[model samples]
Target: MKYDALQRLLVEHLNSRPVPPHAAARLARVRAAALARHAQRQRQRVRLPEALGRWLTAHNAAARRSAWAMAMVTALSVGYLGWAEWRTPSEADVDIALLTSDLPVEAYLHPNFTRDL
Candidate 1:
């Protein structure tokens, strides 16, 4: 409500007043002064290159740490998979055992069957 009242007041004053030529010049000077003050404050605050360098250094360090962690995890996963593969028995292992051993296949297939003496 206060904003609306202020806006109405501004509109009424603008409508009632004749346009002054010096108003534009005064406004331009005000804008320039505000901008100059803002620029001066910014210059007094921090140097741009130093701020950017600090940010970039932090970002690069974080990136390198993430990459190192990812590489380590990937290496561990690959090593685990390789170890599991090496430890597991395969079909070739079974075939080799069957070929090298003298166990009868029928005894495995028919354990319950018996011959009458």
Candidate 2:
């Protein structure tokens, strides 16, 4: 493959090149910065609410897209909560409805119940 030949030439050139004295310090700084960024992102995730953080981490979010992703997560969570609130009856509602009445659950399961109604 063309990529295999290119990689071989690049490897030979790198092996034959002399290492610069300043390269170590530069590499160390770059490594430290990368590690610090990684740690900071971890801290940010920890500080976030657990569900949002889990969703983002599960998807392997990119560092540069985190801000937009966070906004999307929050909006989606809010919309979901709002929708769920409107779509389903709360426990209190069921309790209130049955507070003064009792019905046998088996009544609803009888095959002729609907036909008789």
Residue 112: error of model 2 in Å? 23
Please identify model 2 stretches exceeding 4 Å from their true place: 46-117
Model 1: lDDT to the true structure? 0.85
Q: Which 10-residue window of candidate 2 scores lowest in summed lDDT?
A: 97-106
Candidate 2 at residue 54, lDDT?
72
- Candidate 1, position 82, lDDT: 100
Put down candidate 1 lDDT per residue, 18-115, tens digits, no spaces: 76879978989999999999999787856899888877787877787898999999999999999999999999997797777676866545756345
Worst 10 residues of 1 by lDDT: 108-117
For candidate 2, give the lDDT of residue 112: 95
TM-scores of all predicted structures: 0.38, 0.38
Residue pairs clashing in model 1 are none
Superpose all Cα atoms of candidate 2 onto the true structure and report the RMSD in Å to 1 decimal: 11.4
